[model samples]
Target chain A: AAGMAAPRRLKPLHHVAVSGGTHGNEMSGVYLVKHWLRDRSFAATPFLSNLRAVEKCVRYVGRDLNRTFTAEFLSSAETEDEPYEVGRAREINQTYGPKGSAQAFDFMFDLHNTTANMGTCLIMDSEESLLPMHMCHYIQTHYTQSSCPIYLYKLPGEESYSIDSVAKTGLALELGPQPQGVLKANLFAEMRALMACALDFIELFNTGTVFPAFKTEAYKITGRVDYPRYPDGEISAMVHPKLQDKDFFPLNPEDPIFQPFSGEEILYEGDSTIYPAFINEAAYYEKKVAFVKMEKRTFSIPGLHTLSLSPSP
Target chain B: MTSCFVIHEAPVRRVAIFGGTHGNELSGVFLVKHWQENGAEIQRTGLEVRPFITNPRAVKKCTRYIDCDLNRVFDTANLGRQTTEDIPYEVRRAQEINHVFGPKDSDDAYDLIFDLHNTTSNMGGTLILENSRNNFTIQMFHYIKNALAPECCPVFLIEHPNLKYATTRSIAKHPVGVEVGPQPQGVVRADILDKMRKIIKHGLDFVHIFNEGKEFPPCTIEVYKIIEKVDYPRNKNGEITAVIHPCLQDQDWQPLNNGDPIFLTMDGETITYEGDSTVYPTFVNEAAYYEKKQAFVKTVKVKLTAKCIRSLLP
Candidate 1:
């Protein structure tokens, strides 16, 4: 069988962390983590990352906390005039990661929500690491009951800036169509179920179960398109209504991408078809990205066996 | 066009200010609550101003409505429908409201009714009038426009001449729907709330001046007359495929010309305006209209001339 042979044995996972409220307005993650905190389970641990932003119910008091985890930001000296997220990022680094260190947590899961109509997206950095890829493969196969699509963002050439990057290996669970301040009950339940599945996979991996090699599909980020803007920098066009909630749908060249206030259609000028993610994400409005362009890729993962008998010191 | 306008000679006596007609619209609901507790701000010498929350259940739940939209349930056909067990809460509420404030186009209706509303669209501060021929509403719109800073008020005429309206304010002799926005459905913006309060204050002040028998000079004002509504692009399954384009999203009250982008399809195609002439679009991307199947309401600019009026007093 193509998916049956085993080759590599990876170390058993020990310290797995789940984070929420990275963007305070994402209510599903925030509420799920809050519920977990109330439950007080030591085995299934989760924490709120941005307390100030969560308290105020705003994205962030200073700058986006999720984007403040880079080495440059973590290494920057403390200053009274610096953004609130900068100091908070350093504190988080000390707790979870000091980055690329052996002391870092074994795995992490960052929770997020978007105003864009992305449904149960599993965002990973890249396909370089084997463990995360295998985990993703497991999740994709096991979480078959719902629309769980995997996405590969922050490709090799791009710098990693997300909170999940602090761990040895991790991914972000981004769910949506939820307005910043509002939480849909369905999404909240879906998030809880997804988190539980991720935890189950960790337990399964740690228990020394052999996993078969399998081919899986993921959308990899290629580029981002910004909204059409005026001379004064005011956005002049909106994401075409047709494209608004069509996340992960293949967008062909010359397809309608934008509609200006003047009522003219702007076609996609790209040569090849591409899928889009984060379409009209409310948070990305300030970032100038209307939507992220993606290309679908299938990766073949090698079979994995846990190295539980020989624990690494 | 210099057409003669016949101004209403009756002095406005009782005025009703309604809020929470759409429960998610927080500006009006909160303002009504504030005024109900503190009456000093809305009080004037001759006018008996009353503040009311039309749909308390919706307001309490922070939803638009329970069974149906309260604002759209006030039509004569719905109002006259006999009470039944299966009747919607809003329909029953509308009947009760009609019994209290209106008989529907009768002489016993309130002299002026100003219904407060908010939109998710970026329509600054708007005065929605059903009848542009009514001089009282037009003059009030003109006064509010001049009293506040420029661009503070824009008159929108729905132009329903059939003597039938399903809106909360339409029951009054002179009705004005005060709609302000860019505020999210469930969220309140301090700027939007302040603008709404100012509009109401000026409206009451105008009524006071009219009751005191002041002569008003003839003036011409710009009115956005709604012609038709545009719906979002939908597939065979009736699922909306596109949304209001970003450039046209908040561009309410702005001119739309032929070949201008109106909708962006999910397939990455731009749907431009194919209209032969330029028209103004209002209520662009209203959140509440999603279920109504309306993307935006198209309008044309027309000059409305109002003649001088003096309130008749003994």
Candidate 2:
């Protein structure tokens, strides 16, 4: 989108915030916001999260806008007036949230894309949220054409920091294999479909249409794995052909994971088979992450209290 | 270390170096500054080297350019036009550069031009952006590639689909040098600088050899020949929504097949390469190109032959 219009103040029966461009270069949400901004009939208070970054086509000018949403970070906003993102983060919070407080969005859709082959996945801050889990299950079942996977990225002990984490109830829509600053038509349509589906779910929820109980499969984050490095800490190897682009696939023990410049294949010594995603993600190079491993578990949606009642998940 | 000077050393007439064409690319700015301060250390017999920072305002601001990209404003038409207050900063700079050392088609112009640039792409130590008539540039690259390690001498020859040479290098009667890195903007890496220094030294030596009556062998080198540019997946709003696929990340110079995965959605769907044949990619996820909205460029790997390297010598 050429220009970013400010978010419109809307008074919906249930205030739902649909955001794109939290990481400005990620374009699906950016264009969606731009398009909706031009005509707001379909948009329920559309928010173009990081306008400057969208125009510059960078992730952010300073720190990541998506990663600046934690309560602690928001509380100490004015203490360090350095990066441009901190002020923008506060502006977004004041506009849509101030989350966990009384005046906040009833629901939020934080759109994102990944270098990872994670498919049309729903990323949540907590797995214990009933409404989000139900929404994820509904979207996965309906959005069959798209590779929809659910991931509980934020664990038990982690603080919520993403744009979605700021909403009273929100899930970040993660799409991928598209490069930052570039958008694809097929994927764009898929994201649009998911958004419409999410809006429909919210509508149904408000209308008291109880979603039928269903089992949903999700990937649970365990730990981040970095590239095989030399003693000097330089990455000594790259993702092997077998392991490269195999996001959400089972990574077996003793599998050839890295191919060193010396032509030697490095194996996974861990005994348990773990599913890996975000393999060789461009953004993760700075983070030193080669991939992130997760555990796969099937849990039924709407388990009364939204707790995993079908044994340990 | 493999070859020795025969001592029939004839002086190199003139060579020009350009840096800070894009101010945000720090390696070029810093390297030129270092050379301007202490180029005498690398000084060899006969070659008269001149170094200049092409865009001072951009360099001072730590931006790619001030008014417009200096690299794109170097066409003869733009340079030949009389300067006006209405012209952009880069246009005026190009005119100044042309005045100093150009009318590049002329015989008195700089013998070889080294236009230094850095990128956020994983283009290790690339030499020569593709110019079909520049056989001399390729000869210098051949010498450097054989002399250096693989990481220090990767070849990425970009052939623009429609436009002919418009970069700062195009201003040179004969051009050579690199667009290097995996380095961020406004950042400098010593290792990359070291690589650039080696290439420059070897290039100077090659010129020395060329000036002498010594004949060099006919040569061929494999080059990733850039054919076309691929933009990131966009919505109807023309905004990009995907990141470089993990399969394709840091895969510069690697072969991409017909059905190879090129992009991944945030939702995890794989967007595949629909090309008919396998092609190599370069400038993969280049930071500067992000503003230009280019994800990466596709290239055909080719064996470029110097039909007669020695025959060019008079």
Candidate 3:
């Protein structure tokens, strides 16, 4: 129990513990946290008074904090044997408990950024959880000016796990593909407004007020392409240009990669495209592995209404 | 008297084309006609054009189908079959239309194809098919929604992957159906008529249709099905009854817990219990009930073949 120093007098209302940036590469969520910390006025609103006044705020920088919330990781914190993010997650959990008590914090939000090309999405653990979907709808409705298609997926249902595995309720706001400079700034503001909306809902829930349910029109991507880094000359270096208006990438099967000394022919084997073929060696991870766009079905769902079926007669 | 016109334009590369299948849904028909009437100006402005009218009888009748629904007759076998009294007229019209715009054996085929229409319901605007999650269709879906119906949010782009396949009789063609809202009086019909004109003009402007020099949006072929007909319960007096209550356009239908009554008819009542199943309810008036000649559910499962898969692949 690393940060279990003392049980201070809580404001006796619900608290929201937002933690994200689990993947060091994804930067949107980090900027969102930074935005919240800088724009204190959003957090200062009456809706957030209970937890805002007493709850200890912990912000983890660098490293994936989501993977560290296990019992072994917590025990290792005492020995100082675990990585910094792991130890930090342990400390946060100790202060908040495995599941933040009902008398304390009632919600969590994990923010993240995906590859710049993948569209915007909200990732959750269950279709039954309406909170994340509601927040997704609000953000898409209020913030994005263009036709920003918002997608929602159940975490474990999709064969993936995240920090939501630890918290009873949490939302992972995935900002599709990170743009370079000023656009990035605008993306941060959009993310901040989204955080405010989530925090606002949490406060309403704690006070027994009816939180406005989020209306959602669900969609799923139609195709994806993964570009895994292969041996020295295996992965080719060629510009995969996008067809006009179409998302298809034109890649010839016979293109070759020229490394310092070796070269190999490129094999185009997928149903999608890969643009900007340059590699950033600094990021040892696969250069650019995946591209996904939905075969979208846009149908509206009632706010906070997670019911899969229509009301009976 | 009702007149039908079919127009085709190949602005630049002739990547995609437009076909108005239903004459009653005259927006697309009129739009194509307007372009053809102003052909020289449009040509001077640079748009390669191709257009055709599908069912003149239905256009004259102001109904969905003429004889048999012309759209449902798209399966290959039905191409030349005289299935009804009007079969000769429809077949002749289809042959002439097919020869003009159907896929040529040459590689230079129209990139995208749109079949425009108007719905009987007040719900107006465009509906896009998500047969292929290609960039052009996705962008067009967004562009049309943002540029046209920003207020009613009338543009609906289907995002689901279609598990079932639909065959069109007019030869092998990638088709999309656009439904403008139902217009009864000729004046209101004119409003939709003008909107369709603007959409065609804008589409021409976007693609720079005739100007062979400018780059056009790369086309992605796709296919989708619109609810051509619906079936609803009718009363003893043959009055159409509303099954589920109508709510706001954006409102979510509430979930029924345990036992909930679905509908009440003079033929007795139908209730849904814990284990019983039901379909999504559609609002229908007696007029619509009669016009809804087909059930809303998919009764047949068509086998997916290698040919169909090849056709869909880019």
Candidate 4:
């Protein structure tokens, strides 16, 4: 029983990657990674994900690059008719992932920014993942200037689709309230600090420091809420002005959520209270998501340690 | 011919072009700078075109303003206030601007004022007028409308009785707001800038033609008249919990139906419009208006007929 309760030791990360510019208009990540490449300040391999979109200063040249990383798209044979993002996804998968494999990069950090005022958010693939959880825990406990919220994007057994999913273990660092195509100096600095902290955590873990078990809070995605639409598929309503920048805030049932053109207030009819993130995100409007609803859960993670290279006594 | 109102006005010789009213809006900030350096593009045979940046301090910092909104500081209440050592920066600037281009409703004021602006909303090139009934303004609106693509520019009228507007343009007898957008604050897009340039060119040309004794015939044109403004829903702590419904975003100048959705709450609830009649919305999600506690302004589409205008010079 004592042996079964022992801390789990995992393989040390050898190759870590940091990617940016998956959505071109997100200027913080795009410029941060570019600065890193030019300065050679950070040791991690800096990858600029979408060159064409970055040059154009648009979200993407073809389809959204972040959404183009599913198995169906990655494994499909390359053809002349394939979209630019699809081809890029395949190349990225080949370079970093071939995901869920031993040869895949140990960790990948994808940087993103939202027009929504989400502040600093860390998006993890699963609630149970140990390394990313430890990294997020480290960031939350140590980065005292601002509160960093952890968001669990994947449900149990769900397939991964985002660009960060290419690596074995990954997290998407999202910061915002900054508009697309514009760089806010404060946000850029925050992103840089967060990235440095994450890298420090990786170095610490690599040096074989054991991370203790702890309980932390995270918002898990439940379902997506789309904007109300007309019969012709045109969106009929907008994100309520009340919810414009209240990302990660508790939203109660029967609260005023939307204000239509008629100036009437719309109330939430859900039975349970929920916390929403990405409220009024500019990019999500085109994707039909008014906001992503989330359920707050407290997670207790087990202590983690790097695999012992020496023979056990 | 049927009944028509003919307008005869003294030559519109002194025209002032104001930019950087809200310093973060870059299209006007840069355009005004360009025209101030080289006057050939905006110059006319008989008119003295003065392109000025209203808030240079704010422009230097690339912010909206130093204290309060410069655009809202031009009202008589603020302008007539005693100059104190501790007054807000914009109030002083407004007074200085008034002293140069206006004294607000004085006969010595400039003949016409073209104040440039930008919005975060998807409203295309828009001409805003305080007095929708004025013959010269209506003729200018009609002329600019005829010159540019109809879908690119629309006229919006904010009915402010008693000349109570706080805008910089309100100082002049005839004020035309050349507002364009879908631009994010602090950022400039070539497409948006080019569209603004075209609108200004057409405006200058219209004035040039009018000064040369050309008469504009009476015509009926579609204009959006401001009805009211709605505020965002807030909690006890004043935190917002919803966003502009996706449907309503970027749908500026489009007719908003009674049952259409206008907002979506954070908890994924849909909010529908309950108005009895359809209305058009402008300045939807304007970045500058967020601080003013307004989500969007509603307007009803109406046809405005302008009288025939012949310059008093001829």
Candidate 5:
């Protein structure tokens, strides 16, 4: 396994971690931190990042907080320019970061829920991150009823812009196929279990149990696909009914991807099979992404490779 | 000009046209902004038009609102509050708006209020959501219905149930909310905007004719009154386990009988509407209310005896 060159035992990573609704409308993460805030054993700092947007029941107050956590944005962000999220990112980085600084927290688990029925997923920024792979494997295998699929979403050397990117060690826990602003209790319990499992994996690593080595498969995001647009830039088609909420499902070469205003099926022209996620995401409608395409790959635990996401999704 | 039953005495009618109540819906915001800049654009013989945008900051941000929904903040208990740091953005805006156009119970309030709104639901053309059965509101509905061609601007009136004037339009003598839809928030469709502008003009003309003591021929107006809100079929944990069924999608204004498939679960299980009687559903799968878990609202058709100037005057 890659990155297995470390001594048999590494120090137990009990440094600080934080997670909750980075995007205000995602209620599962918003409430998960809320539950943690009440528990006494919780040492990690919890936050409801976009409190204003939560109250209003919208996605964000200023802009999407998830996309505003780059080092560049943290350094240059004023209380203006994507006003609410940018300022908050600066504050989060100061408290938990000066991002990628090893002197800070060991990891920050960012929780999120999607409008697409993506179910439970562990989103890793880089492919080379070994610890996350083993951890995700443990969760997926242990929880027979619920599979924890890994999705590597990093683009070729692009700096991470998500909330968890500020941490030296972390991953984004996305739970969904749920609607925005609505709290589903079952998903709530599942998210809590996943968080607990993440903590347990860290504890096992710290205490020096020789983890069983295994090759893992992950779907790496290749790029996004947008709805076809007319000359005036208005979308000319919508996601076909066949593909509405089928996140992580395969797109066969001739699969119908979109249904145009004329009601004709627009078939996918790609030659090979690919997985699509975030299908018909309500929030992405404004950003013009119909869905993100992912290519399946096999990587040994702790391997990072350069992958390019398509230009637009 | 259409002939009318003219009466002797004249009455001055003050009408308020409110837009951007939910600021992200651009059609209303744009129309009100247009009128705000060019006040002389819309005119009628005996009517006074007051055009206003309800939530300007939200409009500026191209958001639904800076704080809470302005539409839900106009309840009597929430209105007229002194501005404070703790006060929500919408509550303060609602209070400020109340001073200018409302305190619906007061004599100083506008004679009629038309609050413009948009929805992402498949409801298209002109959808009028009015709560009260006041004769004036019904007459205006009928006038607009007759004004538009059948295929062009088909008007659908939904009688919303009001709880002490919670909505911005509810705080008036004759409040009518014009909801045109299938348009996403922040999108400006020319055809939808033009339909709204035409309805605003019709509202002015209808009220003008009323103020002139002219009577429309007494008529029975059909309207749908909301009775209940139906949510998505949810699991024990409140997560919706199913989606709106294919057969029920975009079936607004059609009679839905009991046992009709309403939702289809992930497991391929179909759930049907359990109500005893057939009811009409509006706002089917409205994107905005997904957070509230309300997939649609069920309503029943009722007829109103609508008379124009005579009913209001007498």
Candidate 6:
């Protein structure tokens, strides 16, 4: 029922939604949004009012809320027996869908956290958007105070079935891993800043001043694994599991998971070191491995909203 | 044996091209080499060509610049005067390259010049023409797009006033720096090289000269957005401690604003903003200037204009 409302009219123009904590365990945005919801003193300011005046605002909880925006999934909600997050995604889409069409919302962001040690990343939908470099610059300047090493991720050719692949303009902010104690509050503030920047871009878009462009060259990756590999034989468990730029294991060369069997020497390949190695012992089979980094190129795409990969040059 | 060739068989017209300023960026290096090896087979009908392989040392080192980004050292007043003997080996090498390519006493050595480079980010696909909205820059963009068939997107032409300070561009009356992306064994380098070669061949066929009246392409200028600045923050033990979030993508991020909580030192005390009333934030790995991981960032936005776009013609 929340999906049927007309789009909210705003003075500036365009609309955007920046949602975090889609993975549940990456609780940075969860707590920040929680704080905003519970604390009146924080939300009563004029800045907070301006943020609320925007077209749409989203605060999500749980994993995979980012994976439910396809037309097929949107059509069969009740009959498909979907989970609450999926249904919530459908509701958001319906309300944000184009004025006459079922597609709702012009821009969307799914915020997340990565391993504590990984670099900050701006993961964008490569197909629909183009200017990742510009976006990276904006993110670095506006969100992280030019202090965090930001990277641009272009989805590999192999793993195009994920949720990020569908949206016209969507970015996943990986605030490095779950924080502990004091670090937790810091992470929340980072998420809050990221959200505020997204809101600013939305406001800029509505003002007709937001011109989006993209670089054609993206970090071309070749492999990704949804499952984790257990140590077999003499090979000790990987003290640090990471993705390789080239080569694959467990069959298909395109297969995501690659592990060195016991007693085998580890070989280092590619220009950079291994990345996105999962540390959580309880990670689901669908959450363990990610795409391996490979060659990338810069290109340009012309459109109303452009996706740019803003990795450090 | 590696030989440098000059093609002046055609009636002399002022056009100079310098490639391989940065040894690591090979698109321009190979493109120039290809033309030299096959000049007779690829020379245009009536244009004079001067090609120089500047910064041979840095090229050997495979660096972005010889000493201090040779591209950044161009000054008309400093012409012919060596800056320093104690500078890095690369910087010294850049001075030599500058002397060889720069105009001696007059500003009429060449009508147009091009300095080529490869960038690490994916932002190098487009041609970067220096600080003017001239016809030469405009036509060069058209020629490049038509000849090279670079990635199938619209070419982005950026103009920075500070670019006038660039050594290669500043030395000549008209100079353009063509960035081809990183050379670190990636597809971007390969594609850009292919495109560069195509443009070189097309230039030979068109017979366009820098000072000659060859029509240039139309280009729009865009500005660069400096998104984030990285600082490495360190703890007392020298281990990386906290990542400060000073800038936010969302507009609601403010200092001590509701959800805003400052990170604490390892001993569990919050680090507050000591400066101005504005929100100060820092990312995770900035350099540790303070004892605690309490660095902050200030975000600013600016727009790029379109009139500065130029072409690498003549």
- The lDDT values for all models are 0.82, 0.74, 0.41, 0.82, 0.73, 0.43
Winner by DockQ between candidate 4 and candidate 2: 4
Over A1-313, each residue of candidate 5 has an lDDT whose tens digit, in order, gives 6566533323456675766778777777876776566565765677777777776667887788888888678988374445787888888888778787866666788888876778898899866776677778878877666877789888887788888777776788888766565555557668877877777777666655567556878999988898888676656666776787678889999898886534478998898999998786667867888999999888765322212233334
Model 2 misplaced regions, further than 4 Å: A1-13, A229-236, A261-263, A303-313, B1-132, B135-314
lDDT of 6 by residue, B175-228 (tens): 666655422311112345655555555554444442243322233433232223
lDDT of 1 by residue, A27-92 (tens): 777867776775676365588999888876668888999888887898899999998888888888
Local accuracy of candidate 2 as per-residue lDDT tens digits, A109-186: 888887566778788865677788877887877777866788888766888888866668788887886656555555
Better of 4 and 6 by DockQ: 4
B272-312: candidate 3 lDDT, tens digit per residue: 32424322221111112234332122111111111101011
Better lDDT candidate (4, 5): 4
Give DockQ per model, in order. Answer: 0.03, 0.04, 0.01, 0.05, 0.05, 0.02
Candidate 6 on A173-245: residue-level lDDT in tens?
6665442111244565566676676566555545445454433444434344332243431112232233332
Off by over 4 Å in 6: A1-13, A38-63, A77-82, A98-103, A127-134, A141-168, A179-183, A208-218, A225-236, A239-262, A268-291, A301-313, B1-314
Candidate 3 residue A184 C-alpha distance from true site, Å? 50
Docking class of 1: incorrect
Name the weakest run of 10 consecutive residues (lDDT summed) in model 4 chain A.
Answer: A256-265
Estimate the Cα RMSD of every predicted model relative to the unseen true structure: 16.7, 11.0, 24.4, 18.6, 10.6, 22.6
Root mean square deviation (Cα) for candidate 2: 11.0
Error of 2 at B175 (Å): 4.4
Residues B88-195 of candidate 4 have per-residue lDDT tens digits of 999999999999998899999999999988887888899997886888888888888888854557899888453235788888989889888877665544456778
Between candidates 3 and 6, the one scoring higher on lDDT is 6
With candidate 3 superimposed using the best TM-score fit, by how many Å does residue B20's alpha carbon deviate from the native?
5.9
- CA lDDT, candidate 1, residue B76: 76
Cα displacement (Å) at residue B57, model 1: 0.7
* C-alpha positional error of residue B12 in candidate 5 after TM-score superposition, expressed in Å: 26
